[model samples]
Structure formats: C-alpha cells, structure tokens
Target: MRKRIIIFDDDKDTRTICSLILEGLNFEVITQENCIDILRILDLHTPHVILIDNHLPGMKGAAGIRLVKESPRHKHIPVVFFTGTNNAQALADEAGADFVLPKPVDLARLEEVIELAINS
Candidate 1:
C-alpha cells in the first residue's frame, strides 16, 4: 500500500514541488497551505508521515511541531522538518522531530527517510 503523506507549507512552489516528488515515489500526498484546523485533515486519514515547513507564516517553527507531537490522535505519525535554513536540522532536533531534511529536498533522500520511518 502507498503511504499517506501530509504536507504543510505556505509556499506554493514548495508545496507543489513536494507533492510532485512524493507522488512520483508512490506516496499519496495530502497538502495544505493552512494549519489552522489540522483536525480536519485528520478526518481524511492519518498520514504515515508528515512534512512541515520549519518556518510557517503564522506559527513559529517549533510551535507547530509541538502541537502535532502532543496531540493524542496524531502523535504517532513521524514528522520531518523541511527548511531552507542552514540550521534546519538543528531546529528539527530542538522540535523533537524524528528527522529533518533541507528544503529543495532531494526526492531520493526523502524516499529513503520515509521508508526508514515506516519500517521503524
């Protein structure tokens, strides 16, 4: 079965690029520009993994990660922080992410990370 992947990013290009890359790898991608009511996305289904922008417009980098990590219903899904910053991986670690990938994410690396997360 294809893994469900939920992506949260404010940039159209980033979101679209990620959707395309993941789709090519056979992941079912569910993307959103707004994180206001992520509960709605949860209703659609629990993604096997989540890809969140390190710097969202309204929310702080780690704040959004905390909310998802703390949520009882959605907590189990592994999250990877994606950012253009040089410190992206550090931020992800601080935010308690399972992994972190530099933005303009390499599709090959992402596929490996996702597979590892799923297998683990």
Candidate 2:
C-alpha cells in the first residue's frame, strides 16, 4: 500500500506543490490550509507522516507539532517541518518533529525525508 502523508501549510502554492511532488513519488497526500483540528484529522486518516509549516495562521507549526506529539494515539506518526525558516532544523527538533525540510523545498530532500521517516 502507498504510504499516506498529511501536509499543513498556509500557503496554497506550497501545499499544491508538495502534494503534487509527494503524489508523484507514490505517496497518498492530504493537504490542509491550517492546523485547526489537526488531532481530528490525524485520527480520521492515520497517515504515516505529517508535514507542517512553522508559520501557520493561528497556531505556529511547532505548537501544532507539540500537540500531535502529546497525543498518545498519534504521537508515533512522524512529523516533518517544511518551512522557509532559516532555523528549520532547530525549530523542528524543539518541536519534537522527526525531520525538517527547508523551503523552497528540494524535491529530492523531501523524498528522502519521507522515506526515512516511514522506514524509521
């Protein structure tokens, strides 16, 4: 079965591009505009991985990551931070994210991260 991924980003273009790239790489991608009801979404889909932007609308991506990590049921799912932030790696580490992809996202790196996350 194709691995599933849930992506959250406020930028429509980012969401679209990532979705297309992941879909092309054989992942089942679900895109969300914000982190609202993230737990609900995770529970509903149970995706293998999640990609979140650090600069979301209401809640910051790090905070959203924390929320996911705090949840006992969904905490094991890998969460990756894909953002333009210069300190993306540090932020992701602080937020308990399994990985970080700096934007403008490198397709190769994205693919590698997803594969690593899924296999780890």
Candidate 3:
C-alpha cells in the first residue's frame, strides 16, 4: 500500500505543489488549510506522516504538532514542520516534530525526509 501523508498549509499553491510532488512519489496526499479538522482526519485516515506549516489560520503549527504528539492514536506518526523561518528546525524540535523542511520546498529533500520518517 502507498504511504499516506497529510499536509496542512494555508497557501493554496504550496498545498497543490506539495500534493502533486508527493503523489508523483507514490504517496497518497491529503491537504488541509488548517489544523481544525486534524483529529477528525486522523480518526478516519491514519497517515504515515504529517507536514504542517508553522503559521496556520487557527492554531500555530507547533501547537498542532504538540497536539498530535500528545494524542495516543496519532503520536507514533512522524510530523514534519514546513516553514520559511530561519529557525524552522528549532521550532520543529521544540514542538516534538520528527523532521523539518524549509518552505519553497526542495522536492528531493522532501522525499528524503519522508523516507527517513517512514523508515525510522
């Protein structure tokens, strides 16, 4: 079965581009504009990984990542924080994210991170 990935980003272009890239890599991708429905989505579809933008509409991506890591059902799933900030890696680490990827995402790096998340 193809690995599934859930992505949360407010930018339509980012979401679309990431989804397309992930799909091309044989990953089933689900895109969300915010973190509001994360629990619902997780309950329905257990994605292998989650990619969240640091700045979101409702909650900060770091907080969202914390929530996911706190949840018993979803805690095991790896999370990657995507941001344009210089401290993206530190923010992700503070939030308990498994990985971090800079915005204007490099497709090759994205693939490497996803593979590492899945394998580890």
Candidate 4:
C-alpha cells in the first residue's frame, strides 16, 4: 500500500504543490487548511507522516503537534514542521517535530525530509 501523508498548511499554493509532489512520489496526500480538529483528522486519515505549518487559522501547528505527541495512538507518527520563520529549527524543536521544512520549499529537501520522516 502507498504510504499516506497529511499536510496542514494555510497556503493553498503550498498545499497544492506538496500534494502534487508527494502524490508523484507514490504517497497518498491529504491536505487541510487548518488543524482545528487535529486528533479527529488523525483518527480518520491514519497518515504515516504529518507535515504541519506553524501559522494556522485555529490551532497552531505546535499545539496540534503536542496533541498528537501526547496521544498514545498517534505519537509514533513522525511530524515535519513546515515554516518560513528564521527560527524554524528552534520552533520545530519546541514543537517536538521530527524534522523541519522551510518555505518557500526546496523540493529536493522536502523529498529528502519526507523520506526520512516516513522511514523513521
């Protein structure tokens, strides 16, 4: 079965591009504009990996990551912090993400990180 990845990003372009790229890589991609119902989403999708943006409409990525991390059922899923901040790494570390991807995204790096997160 193809591995599934969930991307929570507010930007339409980013989500579209990422969905396309990941789909091309033989991944099943699911995109959402916000993580308002993160745990519910996780339960529904059961993604292999999660890519979340820092600035979201309702719940921030860090908070959502925390929820996932705290959940025994979902804690094992690797999370990639996707941000455009200068302190991306620090923010990701604080958020307990397994990896970080900055925007505007570097395609090769995005692919590499996703692979690592999936394998991890």
Candidate 5:
C-alpha cells in the first residue's frame, strides 16, 4: 500500500524538494507552508507520517507535536522533525518526535526511515 505523508515547513524550496523525493519513493505527499492550523488538517485527513520543521514563523515545533498528541484521532501519527542542523536531535526530543533528520536528507536514508516508520 502507498503511504500518505505530510510535511509542514515554512521553507518553499525544502518542501518542494522533500515532496519530490517522497513521491519518487512511491509515497503520497502533502505539504503545508504554514502549520499554524494543523488542527484543520486533522479534520480533513490523517497521514501515516508527519514531517515538521524545527523552525517556523509562529510556533515552536514542540508546540505542534503537543497539539497532535492531544488529539486522539491524530495523536498516534508518527512525526519526524526536519531540521537544517545537527541540533535537530535535541529539538526533536523536546518536541516528542519519533525521529530527527536534517533538511536535504539523504534520499536513501529517508526511504529507509519511511519504511521503518510505517512498519513500526
């Protein structure tokens, strides 16, 4: 089965590239430029995996995760904290993410991570 994924990031280029990479890997990808209204997304659809940016304009990444965790319908969704630096690991921990990966991630690694995330 094809997995559905969601990417929430403020960077346009990052979103575009990641979307392409995931799509190439045979995954269905949805991207959000602004994650301030993630609750609305929960109302629409539930993705198998959610990839969020560490740095955004309005709220912290952890805050986004907390919101997801609070919702029973969406709380079980796996999340990956996408960052541009090694610091992402610490931030991802703070955000309650399942994993942390730097932006412009290695496609092979991403593919492996996706498979693991979906199965786990």
Candidate 6:
C-alpha cells in the first residue's frame, strides 16, 4: 500500500503544492485546512505521517499534535510540525512533535522530513 500523509494547514496554496509534490512521489496525501475534527480524521486515515502548521483557523496545529500524542491509540504515528512561526522548534517540542518543518517550505526539505518520519 502507498504511504499516507495527512497535512493540516490553513493555507490553500501550501496544501495544494504539498499534495501535488507528495502525490508525485507516490504518497496518498490528505490535506485539511484546520484540525477541528482531527481525531475523526485520524481515525479515518491512519496516516503514516502527519504534517501540521502551527497557525490554523481553529484547534491549532500544535494543540492537534498534542491531542494525537496524548491519544493512546494514535500516539505512535509520527508527527512533523510544519510552521512559519517563530520558535517553531520550541513549539514543536512542547507539543511532542517528532519533527519540525519550517515554511517558506523548501520542497526538498519537506520531502526529506516526510521520508525521515516514515522511515523512523
């Protein structure tokens, strides 16, 4: 089966670009604008990796990552905190994210992070 990646970011362009890139790399990519129903989404997709941006419309990405980490059923899945925010590494650490991806996202780095998350 193809590896699945779930992305939560409010920016439409980022989501589209990421989807295209990952899809090209043969991943099944799912993107959401917010993490309001993150658990529901997780239950449905069971992704290999989750990429999230800190700023979101509701249920911010950091909080969403925390929620997933706190869940016994889903905590094993790797989470990559993708953000443009300052102190992103600190925020990702606080939220228990497995990795961090900073924006103006370098597509190559994005792919590298995803690969690391999947392989780790």
Which candidate tops TM-score? 6
Off by over 4 Å in 4: none
The candidate that wins on lDDT is 6
lDDT scores for all predictions?
0.80, 0.92, 0.91, 0.94, 0.81, 0.95
lDDT of 2 by residue, 9-115 (tens): 99998888889999998999998888978999998999999999999888899999999999999999999888998888888899899988899889899889999
CA lDDT, candidate 3, residue 47 = 94
Itemize residue pairs with steric clashes in candidate 3.
Answer: none
lDDT for model 2 comes to 0.92
TM-score winner, 1 or 2: 2
List, in order, the clash count of every candidate structure.
0, 0, 0, 0, 0, 0
Per-residue lDDT of candidate 3, residues 1-120 (tens digit): 999999999999999988999999999999999997788888888899999998899888999999999999899999989899889988888899998899889989998988999887
- The ten-residue window of minimal lDDT in model 4 covers 88-97
The runs of at least 3 residues in candidate 2 whose Cα sits more than 4 Å from the true structure, single-residue gaps closed, are none
Clashes of 1: 0
Deviation from native of the Cα of residue 81 in model 4, angstroms: 0.3
lDDT of 6 by residue, 15-105 (tens): 9999999999999999999999999999999999999999999778999999999999899999999998999999999999999999999
**Per-residue error at 45 for model 2, in Å?**
0.9
lDDT, candidate 4, 7-75, per-residue tens? 999999999999999999999999999999999999999999999998999888988998899999999
Candidate 3 Cα outliers beyond 4 Å, as residue runs: none
TM-score, ranked from best to worst: 6, 4, 2, 3, 5, 1
Query: In angstroms, what RMSD does candidate 3 have relative to the true structure?
Result: 1.0
Candidate 6 lDDT for residue 82: 91
lDDT of 3: 0.91
Count: clashes, candidate 6: 0
TM-score of model 6 (CA atoms): 0.98
- Model 5 is weakest, by summed lDDT over 10 consecutive residues, at 85-94
lDDT, model 5? 0.81
Residue pairs in steric clash, candidate 6?
none
Query: Which residues of candidate 1, in runs, are more than 4 Å off?
Result: none
